[model samples]
Target chain A: MTRRSGTAVLVAWLTLVWVGLWGSVTAANVLGGLAVALVLVRVLRPSPAGAPAVVSPPALLRFVLRFLVDLVVSSLQVARLAVGRRVELRSGIVSVQVPGASDTLLTVLADAITLTPGTLTVEVDASTATLYVHALDVGEGPEGVQRLRASLREQARAVVRAMGTAEARSHPTPLGRTGDRRREGQP
Target chain B: MRDVLSAVLMLTGVALALVAALGLVRFPDVFSRMHAATKPSTLGLLLITVGAAVRMREGGDAVALLLVAAFQFVTGPVAAHMIGRAAYRSGAGAQAGLVVDELADVSAPPA
Candidate 1:
């Protein structure tokens, strides 16, 4: 409940990692981990200006569950794509506008997308609040591109809802519309 | 019964790792290759760790295995993120038949 609880969490996680790497949980290992974790937390503490948003536990749980499902599904999809004889690799970059998200949230969103199969985050343009994602199979053409953009936007929105502040939710941009319009005008 | 379960888990883990290795060789591009490298490999490693923990049947070992899984979960995405960024910056994605270039405007200086 204290302000240092966040650091405590980081310390606990680091301690666990240390124990895991050591492959034992002896008293010495635990004490060493604790000492290391404390020093690390002190040295690498987050700045007040870059404080993470208060996460909604229920929303975060939902997001995690859905993300797990997506991970399994996409892994299978990628596996199939890799092995399939007809390699229809329509790889492309799609831009998504995510307004009101903090730096932490935006980085989380990019990491999530990259971790999922068939997609990688290419660039994050902070000025325009845009994320460029490279997808393995963007499908046929403009319609397929629109569908991918919509899904990516939805994923971004879910992350925002789970971990973003009310200010972020208020200034919502129209999902996929701007990109869709631009694609439509393309020959 | 425990032995049987451990054997099954180990076999499944090995199978997954083999598939991941196959995908690494068979996949055409770096982005797709990265996809093959991260997800299944992490799951495979977790499953193998769990199988070993089950066989060990020691509380401390189990806890250690759990920690291993947790660390893998934390680091896998980070590693993938870095690799993807490097590949994109190096124009590997474009060489792999990239259809659209949304980041062209922003990432132009690097290329």
Candidate 2:
């Protein structure tokens, strides 16, 4: 993968944020923003270790479109559930394994899931690369959990596809634990 | 036309904020409460900021409003995630009506 221009991108984004906060785009503001962004980037840059993931613009666009749709649909779902006469929610924590993803991508995926209405990411087991997600509906039995797991797998796959490199996508990892199948039958 | 649009946006934003408040009171558990707190509030804030920018129509004001909205979008999820993690660790998920506790193994030692 090509080396990421992290510094340039960070500086530009910070400058935009700076201008937005100041509510002005004058030369003085822009210059001050550049100075601040430069300092911030120096302070906040991640250690140079693993190569950064190259984001595919097309995949990123698709991810954004799908996320918007999910956002609206889930918001309405939660709103209805909240205001419904009988609020019957079968919530469960489901562990999803997102293999080969960088720390940044995993955090992004977790944030995206939490931002969605019905699901909140409760924990990220960095050791195992597992995300513990609390879903609003896990159905009646194992089947429900399985279904949710499948959907979460799809979400994780979408994220990896959108942002991961060609190598990371090829060696795809199993999304959930096989042992979960047994526990699914219990509750 | 601008005034009408701004009025509509502001009213909708206020309504969303009201719904978010209702959810905060109505939802049973911390996780669900978080669902209420983040999504609708973020959307409401965005709508209100957009409305304010439209009403002001000044370059600086508009830019500032947009920046506020952007910051909210970025920080809202991060804050929600941290709160959710804290709740999960504290056994808040054990509240009645919670169906499954997959993180039981992870949280057991903490409590």
Candidate 3:
């Protein structure tokens, strides 16, 4: 969406919230909401870096459905682990490489990862766009790290597909997935 | 039937929150404890909000309840990320279970 439209949406959402809070949407309430929302939007504008959040409805549906499934499955896993006895935990921190990902995509990806039980995003290196995620269980050693990282990178790709601009979508995200394809010369 | 369903959902949400606390106590380190605390708790909150909305049955109340849930969903991860980053930086959660520390090479320390 363009900057102007995004601001309009923000204002509209804020106005809705105000009306909802007021319960009965009177003229006074709506006017008050509009004034407050306009002021808030003007005061706290988001950075230009995430200017284009041109979301695809289908891709977003795909991401949201997959995310909900992950949330349910992972929450259950954690719940079971809590109730059940466990011997040794093979938890580890794996750094996922998602270079040039926009801030909005990163935020969405990190939020999804954290909401999922198996993985939590510890740190996001914005310069390189790397996400350092801590997994609840990733088997063991280097291979485990690689596997989790790859999966999380897949999530990042999904976010891109859902929310990325046309240029951002054309990034090397799908062209040559890391380590999977080795027939041609690997980067 | 609606009330019964609402009760079930609310009870399940409460149970999940308990599970979150259990994991927080039992988990080995900071990161793991956070994993336990965050995921289930967020889901539990969602469940509780939905249950309440269903039972309330008023448009205004339902909207408010859902808005609370939405706010929680947006803010929860941000809080966890800050804590996680801080713990990792301070070397707080680097215990024996950590098999891979790939971040050590990249983020040295914020100067």
* Per-candidate local distance difference test: 0.74, 0.76, 0.81
Runs of candidate 1 with Cα error greater than 4 angstroms are A1-5, A18-35, A125-129, A173-187, B109-111
Tens digit of per-residue lDDT, candidate 1, span B16-90: 777688788988888778778876777777788888778886677777777777778777877877777778887
The CAPRI quality class of candidate 2 comes to medium
Q: Write the per-residue lDDT of candidate 2 for residues B1-111, one digit (tens) a residue.
A: 999988998898887788788888898788888888877777788889999889895888887887788889888888888888888777665673567777775566143
RMSD of each: 3.8, 3.4, 3.3
Off by over 4 Å in 2: A1-4, A48-50, A173-187, B109-111
Q: What lDDT tens digits, residue by residue, belong to model 2 across residues A9-81?
A: 7788989888777887789989999999989878887453244676778988998888877776666666676
Model 2 scores a C-alpha lDDT of 0.76
Candidate 1, A51-81: lDDT as tens digits: 3466788989998988877777666776676
- Native A-B contact fraction in model 1: 0.57
> Candidate order by DockQ, highest to lowest?
3, 2, 1
> Whole-model lDDT, candidate 1?
0.74
DockQ for all models, in order? 0.55, 0.67, 0.79
TM-scores for candidates 1 onward, in order: 0.83, 0.89, 0.91
* Clashing residue pairs for model 1: none
What is candidate 1's CA lDDT for residue B17? 79
